[model samples]
Target: MQNEPLAYRMRPQTIDEIAGQQHVIGKDTALYKMIMNGHVPSMLLYGDPGVGKTSLAFAIAGTTKLPFIALNATKAGKKDVEDVVADARISGKVILFLDEIHRFNKLQQDTLLPHVENGSIILIGATTENPFHDVNPAIRSRCGEIKQLKRLTTEDVDVLLKRALEDPDKGLGKTPIKITDDQRLKIADASNGDARKALTLLESTVFASFEENGVTVVENGTLDSLIDRVGVFGDKKGSHFYNLLSALQKSVRGSDTDAALYYLAHLLENGDLVAVSRRLLVMSYEDIGLANPAAGPQVLAAIQSAERLGLPEARIPLANAVVLMCLSEKSNSAYVALDKAISSIHSGKTGEIPSHLKDTHYSGAKELGHGGYVYPHDHKIGTFGGWVNQTYLPDNLIGTRFYDPIDAGEEKRLSAIYNKLEKFKKEK
Candidate 1:
């Protein structure tokens, strides 16, 4: 028999054979009972790649004795789907696994919904993209959603690596493979918590391992080279994604425009445009709030434009927005203020909004003097006198400055405005 690819060979045949995804697949769960009872639901498994979505579907098929038919949204068409449903009718019970189900256009997805709803076929749709956004609502409504968790924690990765190292039939046991503590740590590090990618990397390392001067072992050097060979990140789904996120956050915090730009490039090169846009959107407010309030708006607009115009054309607006954010003045005063407020609440220091600031729309509110609140915007010179409401920010912190403006274009104007406001206050 021809040797199967390590991915195929390593495919888990049962729930016991599976790794990770314990939250959903653990004992006596609704989904688990369905799998064991041969009555699994028409479901959608959504998460990052190589996190066992497809594997779980196959395991469900194996456990239920259901006829399994696999389709790819990237390739399958209306005709292909129709044929699968027709076959499922004769097969008695079927589990039709559709990979990258999000890529299916609306009409194609709509065709599957009726068959799934009527129980002609138990549909197992899988996608790396969020099904809530990417899957057609009609199809989504007909299926139970199972969100596969992303890779996290070294313990999870270690458990997976040890299993792969020991499983003789499916893992590196067929060949002479041994891992040192450093190699194990690096493997775990490289995987970021994704078992499939870790195993693949482990297999590659064993293949690369050779006897040097009659000393045959997969040591740290061989493992490092294999890690590089497996790619900058063995798990494209996990650590690599978060590493770039970390880099982006640090760039914004350190006010390094160049570093932020570099992180953007890295994310784009890895085909993670969505992640890049998301971080930029977050960094805009979290790191750049108040100092350059326009930064968040600009990032959001860029993302909208990118959605309207994709790839090469879209790249320009995205890059332009990133550069603008990097060059913009940054402040975390909003974050700091919220943190203080949260801490105060946690410490049981919560205070009610003063009567002057409270709503006066109700019947008895006017009698309670709620409507007597001063309108600061309508005051002469646009500055109210003795209108201080120290209920939320505390008496001592009433005028405490937080957002110190930098020399960026917009912030320079903001600083000037603040200076002018201070002069007015002094003259009052």
Candidate 2:
């Protein structure tokens, strides 16, 4: 057990050890309450890689003292699930943690449905993919709750790094290692929200350095060498990879065609197709927006082609998407309007839904004055239009506006329609 990798040895024994996921594992949350009460349900843990899915499963089992058996879905077949079922039958309920549960075929997943349904097997399916889109619906619905875990922030990773260094039993407390606060934080930042990466780099950096008279010293450039293993972050300074991505987005948004291409070339040279594809797709909507509505679909098509092609062949389509984004008419109105609406919600400017808009589908809803909603389709004022004015907002905010469409691209037409709607609203 002591010879295991640092990340494996440092698995969180309880929810308290898992950082940056207070939404699920917080003391006041329903999941935490259930765990403390010794009633953990079968659940699907979904998130990016290294985001504590398996750690959470281990923490739950440890807290409840349940038998935990982990099996990778990619390698585990129907027989493996049956073996776990046999164990469950002989020794009471067991926690079956299925890593990469999305990879299991329908038949393999179906084999465990009966055991999971009978309460003999407590299923904990962990996957980096979204279960809603990837998993079999039968398996998804059987899992009572789906918990989403997020990547640890730099600060959170730094905290974990400190704990790993200080713990005497499970960590390197006995080792005479000297690492400064900023040096530790540098490893955390380079980790890119992965706790495993931070700890692994710390272990590697500590071991790679020559031992001085008494201690292993982690100097300024120690972590830089470790980060250089991945080609995308070869920014000499060790932190310019994300900065380069930001420069690409800003250049496209500013309509600097040459600068956008320059950044794109540099990012391409790093061989990070996933990163490049993500930035292009975001730029299509966030920069070009409704001004060039077609830009989104065009960029998506180009990206799909690039992904299918891969690498040097992929760069051609990626460059096309970048050039189109740089030249497309720009507008941020779509997301800006959404941001204003979100701000209003946060500021407590919301009121109860108007009586007409309230749900009338339930029993006895009409008796409570919930079916007063007027159908606009029934009151047509023109042959081509079935428009009737109705107040969607509450009475307190009848005139409050959230969307202010700019006169750019297709929004010019949308702006004219918006004015007409407002005119009819005032008359009503």
C-alpha lDDT values of all predictions: 0.73, 0.85
Model 1 alpha-carbon miss at residue 351, Å:
36
CA-RMSD of model 2? 13.6
> What are the per-model C-alpha RMSD values against the true structure?
11.6, 13.6
- C-alpha RMSD (angstroms) for model 1: 11.6
TM-scores of the candidates in the order shown: 0.61, 0.64
Model 1 C-alpha lDDT per residue in residues 348-386, reported as the tens digit of each score: 864556667788878999787775565654455533333
Question: Highest TM-score: which candidate?
Answer: 2
Deviation (Å) of 399 in candidate 1: 21
Clashing pairs in 2: none
Off by over 4 Å in 2: 230-328, 331-406, 409-428
Q: Which window of ten consecutive residues has the lowest lDDT sum in model 1?
A: 382-391
Position 71, candidate 2: lDDT: 98
